[model samples]
Target: MKKTPHASPAAAAFVLAAALLGAAAPAVARDNPVDPVSNPDKLDYRDVEARRPDFKEPFLRDGVVSRPERFREIKPGITQAQVLAVLGQALKQQRGALGTEWDYHFKFQMPQSANYLVCQYKVVFDDSQAVRSAVWRRRQCLDLLPR
Candidate 1:
């Protein structure tokens, strides 16, 4: 029987080492990386990026959903009507020795957490129906609450 040609073990190992070295070599950026011939219509990438709008405004908030930013406008002595305009409506209300307290609950979401947080904004109004105090607090979801 005719013997088939086969590379020696040493030759095979050398070939493998050469291939690994070539792959491990760091890639060098070409001076003229863009191919004008391949791309018939050459476009300046930098110019396109420069024309794009860079938004710097805040996208996340820490207030109620209806109008979170309005919370900042709340202050003592503000009429109940004004608070209502800002927070929409209280989820629960009750009259106490201190004053009439209103409860505002909202589902607060944070970028880092996978669960939704429960936030409560309690606004206390004096007998005159003017806000006397406002308090805000946040708690994790019921499922996440520690026993």
Candidate 2:
């Protein structure tokens, strides 16, 4: 009679864990597919609106004004770390690294007026986590750009 060898208890546990994790991988990927966008390289507010019809900008915080110059620094292909350096942290509503979109509430002073215009800024990231495009919720916010 030939004797059969058995896996050690620790080795068996490791194999079981590996099998369970391997089985879950596909389902996880399917459940959280990367979001797709039209013209990912040139996404705009219209695309955002099309994908998030019910999305609304959060209320602006008092005394917190975003500099237009800093916003100008945000360009396509920039990394998230660069964005953080330029714009600080995004709004709490943003899902951080787990999400592809980061939202910001910006308030700018109206030229020669006491009131401030609040705009929502959105930064879209590609699958590689690089900035793909940026847009403002309102078209009028473009006026903030320096001529």
Candidate 3:
């Protein structure tokens, strides 16, 4: 059988695919340079620094602290595996301050949502350079409000 101009299989398939993909594509999120970062309101670091609320943390654990049920306790010398084990259960972030005195913060995102909260934990050591208290210290839940 000869294919008609209006009944071309290639064109029909193209049209069907385009229609179906067009309907489904909007549901996906595209992150291009043109695309704005999600949740501009949630950007709090700048705001916090701007206000300059004395960064002085008197106590070792100044912020909220939650012990992970599944993660293991911080033993005498924290290795990447120990830290990663807790992080694996909690949030994920770019590994930083590997040797600095800076607080290692992780952003644990909330239930399949765009919400991200901060969890702060520092690797501490004694004067003898022995890791005496290296654990997840303070965790400030950024997305405390209802979704």
| Best of the candidates, TM-score | 2
Of the candidates shown, which would achieve the greatest lDDT relative to the real structure?
2
10 residues in a row with least lDDT, candidate 2: 30-39
lDDT of 2 by residue, 52-126 (tens): 644455532432586677777888899999999888787743433434888777788888898888776778777
Residue 52 lDDT, candidate 1, scale 0-100: 27
**Per-residue lDDT for 4-87 in model 1, tens only?**
999999999999999999999999653323333322222111111222254443322233544345566788899999988888
lDDT by residue for model 3 over 22-58, one digit each (tens)? 9888664433212122222121221122234555643
Q: Give the clashing pairs for model 3.
A: 64-139
Every candidate's lDDT: 0.60, 0.67, 0.43
Residue ranges of candidate 1 with Cα displaced over 4 Å: 1-67, 138-147
Give per-residue lDDT, candidate 1, residue 16.
Answer: 100
Q: Which stretches of candidate 3 lie over 4 Å from their true place?
A: 1-47, 51-73, 78-102, 111-114, 135-147
- Write the number of the candidate with greater lDDT, choosing between 1 and 3: 1
Residue pairs in steric clash, candidate 1?
Answer: none
Q: Please identify which of the two predictions, 1 or 2, would achieve the higher TM-score against the true structure.
A: 2
Residue 23, candidate 2: how far off, in angstroms? 59
